[model samples]
Target chain A: MEWRAAVRVTLKPGVLDPQGKAVQGALHAQGFRTVSEVRVGKYIQLALTAESRREAEEAVERMCRALLANPVLEQFAIRVWPAEQGEEETP
Target chain B: MEWRAAVRVTLKPGVLDPQGKAVQGALHAQGFRTVSEVRVGKYIQLALTAESRREAEEAVERMCRALLANPVLEQFAIRVWPAEQGEEETP
Candidate 1:
């Protein structure tokens, strides 16, 4: 089954994302005032075909382990979607 | 309307993700030998109610600009989904 995988990797909240905080300050400088928060993170879009949901999760976990994420300071969430649905669905 | 948002930011390739590379090496050292890539990042699950899809995106973009990402080194994408769809849709 060809699926869409969204892999999010972010720094642990208490770890101090100065980069994120700095960007937050910059946005305030830019005048986009409605911004309530600014925490920087990574999103990986993968193109894969799996036989089952389990297989896809395992594949994404593998990708995270190899090229998609770091486990020590960051955490991730994996959602597998069937290729048929567009942005209208949520996991 | 309540919706879901996914944010992704990655270090520019070749910018030296030593942290990510180190974790990749560690995964290799472990027994999960099939992992092909592991890069490390953040996932923020937001529960927001918006008037429209555009509003939701603007909200997340605001979040990214201020606290979620560093414009100097990162980028992001926003997708909005209705609360009715479960985890089976693709964006």
Candidate 2:
């Protein structure tokens, strides 16, 4: 079966996020005074072939640990679903 | 009232994604043979002061258009909810 997964990788709490701080400054300069804080993270979408959803999820978890995320400074979350006809296409 | 918003920014379907291709190559080289495709995007979390959820959503939409996302090359989605006691803190 073909599966699609979405991974969200965020910095662990207490880690310094200079990119987030820079974005926050840019927002403030644009006159968005209501914005109090900003943090930036990564969103990754993957398409894979697996026997079942459980297997797909487990593979993605390993992928996260091996390369997708930095265990010491980042945490990740994953969501999986069966791929639709056109959803798996690279274009 | 304080609100928290999450924004996901992705490249438009036809946009070139060298980053995604590089990651996919890295994954395949790492022996994750089942993987077929990968796309990378951005996730942004914001803490802001707003009178209501609707207001917060609107403000975030505006933020995405004005700064967070490039309209010509990317698309974005937003979700907003009331801020929890500790969620609004910058640290």
Candidate 3:
């Protein structure tokens, strides 16, 4: 079966996120006055063949640890499910 | 009240994503031969003050339109919820 996966990689706590801080400042300057903080991360979507949901999840987790995310500075959450016909349009 | 929001930005269908293709090739080379495709996107986390969930959602949508995402080549989904005590640690 083909499975679709999404991995969200975010900076760990206490990490200095200059990109996030710069975005926050930009938002404030643009009149989003209530925005207090912003954090930026990466979202990766994958399509793969797997025998089962569990297998897909494990593969995705391994991908995260190996290449999708940097464990020292980042943490990742993964979501996996069977792929739908038109799901590829949106990722 | 303080609200937490996540914005997921993905490439629009039919858009050329060399980065995605590169990652897919890398993954396949690493022995993940079953992998068919990959897509890359951005995930943004925000902390802000809002009167209600609706307000928070609106602000986030506006942010996506104005700065966080490029509508011509990308689409974005927004998730808003109340801020939890330690939620910032992961985003």
Best candidate, DockQ-wise? Answer: 3
Q: Per-residue CA lDDT of candidate 2, range B1-91, in tens?
A: 9888888888999898999999999999999999998999998988999898898999999999999999999988887878884542211
TM-score, candidate 2, is 0.92
Best by TM-score: 3
**TM-score of every candidate relative to the true structure:** 0.53, 0.92, 0.93
Instruction: State the lDDT of candidate 1 residue by residue for A17-43, as single tens digits.
Output: 776666656656777454445556665
lDDT of 3 by residue, B1-91 (tens): 9998888899988998999999999888888888898999999989999999999999999999999999999999887889865463322
Candidate 3 yields a Cα-based lDDT of 0.87
DockQ of each model against the real complex?
Answer: 0.17, 0.47, 0.56
> Higher-TM-score candidate among 1 and 3?
3
Task: Please tell me how candidate 2 rates in CAPRI terms.
Answer: acceptable
**What's the distance in Å from true for residue B48, model 1?**
12
* Worst 10-residue lDDT window, candidate 1 chain A: A82-91
- State the C-alpha RMSD over the true interface residues for candidate 2, after superposing those residues: 6.0
